[model samples]
Target: MFYRHDNWRVGLNFKNLFDKKYYESQGDWIRSGAPFTVLGTVSVEF
Candidate 1:
């Protein structure tokens, strides 16, 4: 979701909305993935 007004802007982002469990493998390494993450941002221009 996002919103904008004049010179100001706002936004939201979701990486993992379901809160699921997962993993990742790279070469000889194993890593766990992020769960149920939410990111938000805002900006203004002069």
Candidate 2:
């Protein structure tokens, strides 16, 4: 979800809500998994 104003904005987000196992492969290395994550942000533009 997101919101915007004349000079300000706010937003919220969630990643891996279910805490599912997510894997990332880099070269020959593999990441196990990532847990659920939540994020929020605020911004202002002049």
Candidate 3:
């Protein structure tokens, strides 16, 4: 984590580490989550 009063921060996230297959359903409709993903993020607090 970044220190307090910091001007900016950076972070990384990894999702679906195993890359499995699955489905999400609602109202006879289906959606799927990603198999594998990587993300980078930045934040600035006022």
**Whole-model lDDT values for every prediction:** 0.93, 0.89, 0.78
Model 2 stretches astray by more than 4 angstroms: none
Error of 1 at 13 (Å): 1.0
Residue ranges of candidate 3 with Cα displaced over 4 Å? 1-5
C-alpha positional error of residue 24 in candidate 3 after TM-score superposition, expressed in Å? 1.4
In the range 2-43, model 3's lDDT, one tens digit per residue, is 333468778778888899998878999999977888888788
Residue 9 lDDT in model 2?
A: 92
TM-scores of the models, in the given order?
0.72, 0.80, 0.63
Residue lDDT tens for model 1, 1-46 = 9999999999999987998899989999999999888899999989
* TM-score-better candidate, 1 vs 3: 1
lDDT of 2 by residue, 1-46 (tens): 9999899999999888888887989999999776888899999998
Q: Quick one: best lDDT, which candidate?
A: 1
Query: Candidate 1 or 2, higher lDDT?
Result: 1
